[model samples]
Target chain A: MNKVLITGSEAAALGAKLAKIEVLGYYPITPAFPAMERLSKYIEDGELNCKFIRVESDHSALASVLGGSLAGARSYTVTNSQGLLLMTEVVYHAAGLRQPIVMGVANRALSAPHSRFPEHGDAVSQGATGWIQLFSENNQDVLDNTIQAFRVAEELRTPVMVNYEGYLQSHTLEEVFVPDQGKVDAFLPLKRMPALDVTNPRGVNTVAGPDVYTDYKYIQNAAMEQALELIPKVAADYNREFGANSCGLIEGYMMDDAEHAIVAMGSIVGTARLLVDELRKQGKKIGLVKVKTWRPFPAQAVNQILKNVKYVTVLDKNIVFGVGGALATDIKANLYGQGSMVINGAILGLGGGKCGVKEIKEAVDHTESSENKNRSEWIGL
Target chain B: MAVKNLPIVPSGDPGALVEAANYATWRIFRPVITESAKVNPIVTLYCPDGAITVDESGAEVNYKLCKGCGICAKESEGIQMVPEYTGPKGVF
Candidate 1:
């Protein structure tokens, strides 16, 4: 295998092509369009053979892919920001029907004021949709996770969303290892749900009345709970087969024996990794917890690592209006009964605002000096 | 085809819960698309119980198979929900 420098969009396209997806559907949106563009080129140049449908809207893109998956085709799609919001209806539909349609999300902030950059709000807002959510820290993680998503989603019979920061990973160029197509195909065989065939027709997305609607949703929830274990098992298999360490649900950097740690996801984790190294050189006990998987919430992993740490700061690029950062809320909830540990919630990088190293250092300083144990601070505001 | 005569709702439920039985006999007026309509009457995706089937001739709704959610009638332009039977003999 050769190492090549490519943007996150290109890596995503290459990953999908390698996975041997039989159908690709998407509507172009900023920061997310580049992946669709590359996939289209792959189809045209005969490098890949797949049914490429450029739908009129994001909703149709998701719906078409959902139908395609039900028809026994390995399907994939991409969307971002408002496009993701538009497709929210089918996002739930795909998950409810257990369609296993893999999607790439160029995670961007939603708009009333209209701004384009990197924010996790687009994907975080869909937390209740019952889709397995995976966040990437860089271009490499974006590609690896996208490839791994199909396997995870198919194994669990649930839809999976692979999210990377818009522009940060989508446009930024980084050196990535291009895995062999044979190995990817070996890892992910052509497996489809038993439905949409005329000869052996099976009903999907059936209407369950009040008597059985709760049971239907209960089964869906049961499948979602499987991801808490299955995601890591799939990652371990990928690591053994490809010899790549890019896939995981959560990654701790220099976390051992640290009193205070910074917790975050997406490309901000990379920045926090660098900051961790810088602080370690000056004999500071600060660490970083990179949350790669957000949907299952990684509750066990988070509680295990942070239980001993005295103070932890959760950095989120997404905020829930009056409620503070969404990730922070989950962390506080998970650590509720774990003892006298302090958790700080900080919201930064809204509407593509840069979460710089300076601001991160200042946040740590504020946490150290302030008497308030549980504080929510807005960085670089 | 022999029609299976069985209760749609279970027997051991509360009366209020069993009220859903009213929907069982409640017939959904299947929309008939005239030849002059120049449109397909098929429901593509939103059929709740896979009630709508489309073939070469056109779209057909199996009322017995339908959940009677009326999603097809509500969402599809060419379909409309009418009473199961307009005559007195169709009373539930």
Candidate 2:
């Protein structure tokens, strides 16, 4: 109804309620657990009415949601980190069958040390799963993206993952504008989805054989490529409907007249915006390119945005083992041989290690001074 | 939005050709309806792979897709399971 201070988890839950999801499935895990908790609270308090099932594991959570979707109901679930990894197989199944389910992924570090903080590793690892992946910078981004994902997923008959940092965006409170029920209802008009019929039962996941396997995947690829264009159109329509300009595939913050740009994703982009502002006040010609969409990599838009910049510093929250950061690899692959633009990856945070303005400044300093643009520097190690 | 609104056939819808394959090649033994067995055998529902069907006429195992799992013969009285390659001249 108005601007309210709420955590991203609560905001996402409210957004799902606003979108009138028919079923909610979840198996609790850290960071993402709170969002599920908030949604359950909504159900308990009668703020939202839906089928809420607490399954045994993340795998079942996804499967249960798939059942709901198959039954022709608007459905969603929440999980991140190890839970996301566990649901990998079902995630592919959801995409393969063209089930329009939306999921809120509070991104967290993949475990080994069993750390508890933010990292993009969890959601980034699912790049090939064919779900339209959208990253959020704040609570509002999380909420808007949750609702926007429904439209995208349902309209395209593809699943979507709205990702934000685990602790940074999940637990921390921010002032977010909560849309009213009437407007949200108008924004998301209910449409009957293709449903399972018991009277005339149909099989699910039958073999595609060699005759149609590649054809099915080709359809999937075409749908994904279509998303590359549909996403920005949805964002434009959302901005027109909601009067909010933050919904898009990428945010080119102060890129005009800039000589250098800092490319990053998720909550780090919010932090980088401040750093970019401070540096600009000191007469530095640096700008921030916050990547809002990852799965539909948005390479053309990114290429155009960074075309004139002579230096591009990349900040990747997740490392790709032997290779550089995932975002860095993506940006490098897109920009290779295009120009004399020097690109360096500032490996600032992995496993939720401490990364702040100071650490980011060190990376920026290295980018501004270093001659070798080929190596990824592990800063604040 | 063009592909988004299009009705794409989902993966698991049932049909006669649903999951069809040349599964009979994987069969160790074949299912047959015998004269002494029940008139209308209930072996139609036992095949997990949907390889066998039965009516008042008897059971017909679609060998093209039957894996010779012996599920029908084990579950119903009218069906019998026999080794596909019982001699040197057998296909197996």
Chain B: TM-scores of all predictions = 0.50, 0.60
What is model 2's native contact fraction?
Answer: 0.51
Best by DockQ: 2
Model 2 interface RMSD, one decimal = 4.3
Tens digits of per-residue lDDT, candidate 1, A264-332, equal 998988888888899999999989999999997899899988878888888989988888899888999
- Please give the fraction of native interface contacts (Cα pairs under 8 Å between A and B) kept by each candidate: 0.00, 0.51
Local accuracy of candidate 2 as per-residue lDDT tens digits, A1-381: 588999988888888999988899999898998888888888899988799988999999999999999889999999999999999999999999889999999999988878777898898789899899999989999998998899888888899999988889899999998877898888788776755778978767666657567777878878888888888888888777777766578889889988989998888888888899899999999999988889888899899999999888899898878898888889999988789988999887787876777778888888879999888989978
TM-score versus the correct structure, for each prediction: 0.84, 0.88
Model 1 residue A128 CA deviation (Å) reads 0.9
lDDT at A205 for candidate 1? 54
iRMSD per prediction, in order: 13.1, 4.3
- What lDDT score belongs to each candidate, Candidate 1 first? 0.82, 0.84
- DockQ, structure candidate 2: 0.33
Regions more than 4 Å wrong, model 1 = B1-92
Which residue ranges in model 2 land beyond 4 Å of their true spot? B1-7, B10-19, B29-92
